[model samples]
Target: MSLQALWNQFLADPGRILNDLALFFTLAGAWLLLATRRREQRATARLVPQNEAQAVALDESTARMNRFFYRFGYGCLMLALLVSWYSTRL
Candidate 1:
């Protein structure tokens, strides 16, 4: 289908959009968390690097990753809540 057709389809069913958003975020958040965990494991398994810069970068990466996934997870959940609220109003 064309892009416009797809957009029109989604608009026709507002609840479906919210549900799809919730599902997408749930999956994306879980994957981000898992990937971060794996990266942490691999980081520890590696021998200490001669450069101090690498350690600093790793710490920064972990913090950023955690924040992003946490926000993403919560935001999507909020969207699901919004959907429910909207349904009641309808």
Candidate 2:
């Protein structure tokens, strides 16, 4: 199909495009969250604490990163849901 025809098709029903985009982001966010968690866990396991202070700092940083990832992943999911809902209503 020609580029113009593809564009016209999308323009006729833009909801499909939004829904697909939301689905893609939803999956990507979830995968990123899981992968980060696993990687951090492995790194933490291999770490040899040279001092108590350093270990505490590392733990704090890891906690902060974990919280950030959780929030980011959930935010993406919520946004995707909102987009999906809107698309359905369109």
**Largest lDDT belongs to which candidate?**
2
Off by more than 4 A, model 1: 47-90
Model 1 TM-score is 0.53
**lDDT tens digits, residues 1-90, model 1?**
999998997889867765676667666656766776777668765635556556534577676876786677566656656765665564
| Model 2 regions more than 4 Å off | 1-7, 47-58
Task: After the best TM-score superposition of candidate 1, give how far the Cα of residue 11 lies from its true spot, in angstroms.
Answer: 3.1
Error of 2 at 1 (Å): 11
